[model samples]
Target chain A: MIQNLTTVWRFRHFLLALVRLDLRLRYRRSILGVGWSLLNPIAMTIVFALVFSKILGGDDLTRYVPHLLIGLAVWGFLKESATAGSRAFLQSESYIRQSPLPLGIYPLRVVLGQAIHSTIAIAVAVVVTLVYQPYQPEPTDPLAILSIVPGLILMFLVAWSAATIFAFVNVYFQDTQHLLEVAAQLLFFLTPIIYTAGKLVGKAWWWLELNPVQIILELIRTPLMKGHPPTADRLLAGLYLAVVMITLAAGTAAWLRKRVIFHL
Target chain B: MAKIALTDVSLTFTVHQRKRVTLKEYLIQTVVHRRSISTAVSVHALAGVNLSLRDGDRLGVIGHNGAGKSTLLKLLAGIYPPTVGTREVEGKICSLFDISLGFEPEATGWDNISYRAFLQGESPASLRGKMDGIAAFTELGSFLDVPVRHYSAGMMMRLAFSIATAIEPEVLLIDEVLAVGDMAFQEKAQARMKEMMGSARIMVLVAHDLKTIRKMCNRAIWMQQGRVMGAGPTDEVVDAYIASVTRTAAA
Candidate 1:
């Protein structure tokens, strides 16, 4: 574990380069460039808000739009990143075969790139909410500010582990790629991004507790949107999951690092 | 003192030949560990091959396909850990085993170059400064801004080879990469490699072009069926390897 960390630290620049490469490649040929980062989520939020506000008639959705946007941005980042990153090693196998750098940097780069894209999404949410929604500044909500940084960190860890673990599975089973897409889609709906846990306050509430994404959603949402101080439980849960996933991912990567070449 | 040392190094891989695709059979196989003798077998890619290369020694590797020539290059580059025994390498090693392997098909030629270089351990700062030189060397010219996916196989190899040799690695591990590109480009690349050799570094060249090997390498190792058949002066090893191939063909 220490060895992995040391290796990642040494190749920190490669991770940054990967993030830059991802961003450039993302909007390279597009007319909108980085603006699409915001446009994508806002567009989805508009569709959701219009449907929920007009057809469903939910209570004052003015706040809910920004809330939903933030949640979706975070969740979308996690979902798409894991999906893309799961194939990180496979995709970069050529680079791995040619270059002499440490292998972990590729997965880490995948996470960092997604984190940057997600940050752009979050910035869009902030802009839309502050300008149009009349959101009053809540200076005392340190959690809100903390959310910006830690949310990215947590998302990165989740993405790193998800992509790397899937890399292992992808090597052994090519069909795992389709399975991953299905799994990500299911996870998106299962997580309480579209609605609150209170809405499901019934026999099916246990479903929320069982979801690993619940803590992740709450981790970002509690500090960013809800403006609630990060409760000890939420912090502990986030930290615990991050530690566990990182260890598992690192262990799997180490075990599969050299072996993956043969399989390829 | 900078050298690559392989001591009793062996690499074994499990070869699974899928004969039929059935979920029930797959589950049963997973649970029961039942296997038909024909479905799968274990194969050794490299079997306890030991070698040592000191600085300034150009070692050539000649082998038939699947005879572990590429595996040896990968192990030397530290891309693979030996399944059994130890391999130690000391120096900055750069490998051109898979040219254009890491390239993003969607990215521009220049963009791919930087990304590939950064992956090869060139600092971003260095890559930024060296981008123009790499582009010039490849003569990719106006195509630098074009997406790499549109490049032909030869174009891809040109770009890959140019970007790989841009860095001055102390130990270079190449597998059939020098055979890439047009004759002019090949000459330029060979000249660059010759210049690089003057820096007194080790190079492991894996190729079937015996003439080029004899020209570039001082010593050569012939491998057959995952074991070293012969190792000595380049001409002698090449002669023996050719004789063995002739004997096998005659029989």
Candidate 2:
């Protein structure tokens, strides 16, 4: 694992170039360029606020808008990274066949590329927060910035782990990408992104506790929405989940590294 | 010194006859009907074979399509792990199987050069000094600023070949990609390849051009049906391979 990490670090320039190339290719023909990244979450937030605010029909509009926007932006990152990472190896078959590099770099490239897009989404969230001042209390906690540190790191690790695992399975099972798409769609609704976790009680609350996505959501959402760091228990739980996911991802990648070439 | 040794190495590829079924399809199929998915068909790409190479070895591989010449090169380059045995390689290895394999069509020639070299594990700092030389060799001139998609096939090959051959490694692996481009570029490429072959400690080339192999390689291997049919001095192997082909054609 150390050797693999070293190899990846040594080839960091290549990975960065690949990420840049992916971003350029993705938006090359579009007139708006990277404006789409910011627009996507903003558009979704407006639509969700319009529908849910009408259904719930309460004074929760100000509170819910920022919550939904942040949640959607983060979820968008997770969804794109996981889905694209799953196809990383398959998509880079040309490079893999011709050049010899550590296989881990491909998935990392996907994750990092999506991370950049997600950073843009986060920037949009910040702008929305500043412009609309949606938080009822207007979170003044100076530590809120510090709280986001762990959440961001944990989010990247989880996304990277998921992507590596997906990329590995995708080589042998071509349907993994489609499977991930369906799974991500289901997971979006299941997680407490649109609705606050505080609203759930008893059985519903138990479901949220069991859901890793909800835990991750809380890890990030608590800092931004509630003006507080996540509870110690919640932080520990998120860390443990991240660790387990990374371990499993690394184990599977090591076992499948050479074998993936055959499938490719 | 560079060295490569294979001990009874073998590779098998399992190709699925049917497309992979999604979870949705699988669940629906299981519920609606009682049918299982099709199994994959395994192809023995390379049978058990043992070979060894040391410094200053120029090994030429000649075989018909699907006869495992490329597979052998891939194995040596560490692209595919042996399914059965073991392979030990020492040195920095550079494999140029598909010259244009990693080029982004929408990226400019200069960007593609950096991208391709980076993929080969060259850092931007290390490659900066070599950039001008590679650019000049490609002869793309102002075309370097244009996207590779706009370049002609020959121009693309020139750019790919230039970037691929820019750096020298301890061991070099080449497939038949050198067969492209104009006659002038081919001669220039051949000279560049000869220089690379001389500088590299170990070189393995897979090509169909018998004359080139006989002239360039010290030793050669002829493969038939995933097994080495003959291995010996380059001249003898080329003569025997040509004779077998001509005799089969006559028959």
Candidate 3:
């Protein structure tokens, strides 16, 4: 599946075209236009902060607002990418059933689009964080911008693989659509997107440490938010986890390549 | 020479059929038969069929629906890998299996054409430049800016046919798509197809129109019940296939 990375490069126009459609049609009738991208996260953040931090006996989470915003921005993109990627082919069955593309590329496009949307949110988050608490993030934290490159790459892989795998699975199983949704919902809480590892005290923290999403976001957030470089060891561990997810996704793509047309 | 080669290529599909599930049956199937399940059938869509094509060969395939004509075209186009035997082809191939396969109906004519052209294998930058040309060919005029779903079926076929043929692939596989358009569009499409044949390309056409096949194709293959009944020059092959069908119906 990876052999054709350059093939997709050749279809750069198709990818850009899809990205244009995704952004354009996403809120066509809605009045807000692209402003909705910024509005959604800000609204969600305010609601979560008000509901969880204030209404519940939640601790002072003012510092956690930026943290939560960052996590949500990343998670929202990842989740949306996964959701879109998995359904890309099924939604575009009219196209895939006829045209000759690698098929794996469609899901990758969904992820890239989602990542672009996430980037917008990240930009919004950066501005909002600085405005709310200018003194907190260190000057060195701008180096964290470098983390975007790796984050984007990993996000693309996850989206590509999920889309490719699901494109086949949903066609064959039909029930897999529901199964994946349930699984995605479960994975949402397992990852420390809403709360931090620091919040979980002591011996019980092992599960949080084991969560790959935690490691991935930390690799991203530490450099950008704290102005500190993520340790070499943590980066390696995140890369290892990413490799496993990508391999599993590729395996599904190889298995499904021939089978996809049958379903179509 | 630009060509497509199929050496004893075949494809079989395994389909799993489930017991029709009511709410109760669904629960039982999920809970009890989750692992030990037994309800499926296998279908063989294509049997070993050898064929080869050189540039300028417009080979027509005629058969009943599901007679593997489309399957053969797909294999030649490299959309489906053959389950057995080798299928090889040289030069770029474009397939028009369905008239509206690549268009996003909700997208504007300009955006969808650019996207569809690229998916058909044109370079992105080139597709960008060719967008106007594609739209102009559609004859949709200013309506080209509107979403495609608003267009009638004839209009959609015109747009799809225009974008597909615009790329001028070295090998072109076309299903029975031209039948959908109006007479004028059909004439235009036929002319475009004839123009394409004059170039260095192999054309594999699958159609129910025997007259059109006779007019356009140099060679023809007639398929029946997943087997080839006759293969030769267009008139000879069509006559043989008709006689066999007549005999079968009489019997």
Preferred candidate (lDDT higher): 1 or 2? 2
- TM-score against native, each model: 0.86, 0.91, 0.89
TM-score sort, best first: 2, 3, 1
Clashing pairs in 2: none
TM-score for candidate 2 = 0.91
lDDT of 2 by residue, B1-251 (tens): 88999898889988877655565566677677877664678989999878899999999999899999988988888777789999999998888776767678888999999988887778889899999999999888999999988998899889988988898889999887466588988999988988998899998989888887888899999998889899889999888999999999999
In model 2, the Cα lDDT at residue A180 comes to 90
Worst 10 residues of 2 chain A by lDDT: A129-138
Model 2 Cα lDDT, one tens digit per residue, A107-203: 8999998999889888777566556665445576746746877988898999999999999888766788988988888999888888777667677
DockQ of each: 0.41, 0.54, 0.46
Estimate, for each residue in A1-264, the C-alpha lDDT of model 1 and write its tens digit: 677678677667756766787788888888989888888788888888888778888646866777788778888887877777767777777767665455667677777777787888877766655544433345455435465566557767877887788777777666676777888788777776776566776787677655767867776666555455457777777778788888888888778776676666
What digit string (tens of lDDT, one per residue) describes model 3 on residues A1-264? 556677778877877888878877886898987778778788888888888788785646656677778888877876776666667777777766676677777777777777777888888767766665533445565555565566556655655666666756666555665666777788877777776667677775777667756767777666556655677787777777778778887787777777777665
Off by over 4 Å in 2: A27-32, A127-141, B24-36, B63-65, B229-232, B235-251
Q: How much DockQ does model 3 earn?
A: 0.46
Docking class of 2: medium
Off by over 4 Å in 1: A9-14, A127-144, A202-206, B16-40, B63-65, B209-215, B233-251
Per-prediction tally of clashes: 2, 0, 2
Docking class of 1: acceptable
